[model samples]
Target: MAWELATSCTNQRVVGSSQIQNEAMQIGRKEIKLNTTSRAYVDPDRINELKTISSESFDLSKLIRLCEELNICFAGECYLSMVMLTRAILDHVPPIFGSSSFQQVANNYSGAKSFKEAMQNLENSSRKISDYYLHSQIRKSESLPNVTQIDFSNNVDFLLSEVIRLLKK
Candidate 1:
């Protein structure tokens, strides 16, 4: 499904641009149009659910417990799930790429000779990732709202502004 969508869209980068365009054209006489409204058509109920989950307060100990229960490494899906769990407990923690603090938590847990050490380590990692997500990505994205606007000029600022905007949300 994803491959079809990628191949059927002009905006997507699917290998060589010319080859993709050619293939898309060959598939049909009409050119494939990009579906740029996916993000705009967000469901209000889902948004509300996200808000409810994202605004909850996270407990470090709870994460450790869940990790133990799941018996999963905090590297791939486990890390992403942990991030979601954290977001459910903390609204300010944006779901930015690489924003998950699972590594820090894992590190602390491993280094801990006592409960306090583990707690402190988790707290430190969580704080760091949270600060990076909220201040850097969120702030930059908000500071520029016209990111979706594309330009063919040397004005890189315009492109960056849009990139920042997407990151913020």
Candidate 2:
């Protein structure tokens, strides 16, 4: 038996919907998103997926921002930022559920007060995942190479879907 036969490939998510739109401009920590009206929203790009649907049941803006950041991370070719945004979104949503269980997280979204504060709390939380590259500003010869764009993109896709599923619940 060969190593290829013994080792199995596992791709949990399909990398289709998490791609950047054909028309988007990347700026520093921001993206200029072109809307149908020929307008752009600056910073924390809000490209709403459910633009037609009213979000009276649950907040949709944050989820959309995740999508936008994903677009920015890819369009801008910054894997580190993409990873950060994805992980941050996951970390932030726990409070919405009132618990940190995104594998089907605990969310009491109805009890939620402020979106901004919730995000801040999670950002400051201990479970927040940090990128090895960004944290290791002082690169060491022994340190491993930075995460590849493909890996980051796939992770974003998986995490995005999981968060969306949790929200829809």
Identify the candidate with maximal TM-score.
2
TM-score of 2: 0.44
- Per-model CA lDDT versus the true structure: 0.30, 0.40
Single out the weakest 10-residue window by summed lDDT for candidate 2: 1-10
Model 2 clashing residue pairs (backbone) = 97-106, 97-107, 97-108, 101-105
**Model 2 C-alpha lDDT per residue in residues 21-137, reported as the tens digit of each score:** 323322222332232221121122223333333535557666665655454444444455655666666655554455665433422344234533443434333123344544655
Q: Give the runs in model 1 whose Cα sits over 4 Å from its true position.
A: 1-81, 87-113, 138-169
- lDDT (0-100) at residue 12 of candidate 1? 38
Q: How close is every model to the real structure, measured as TM-score?
A: 0.22, 0.44
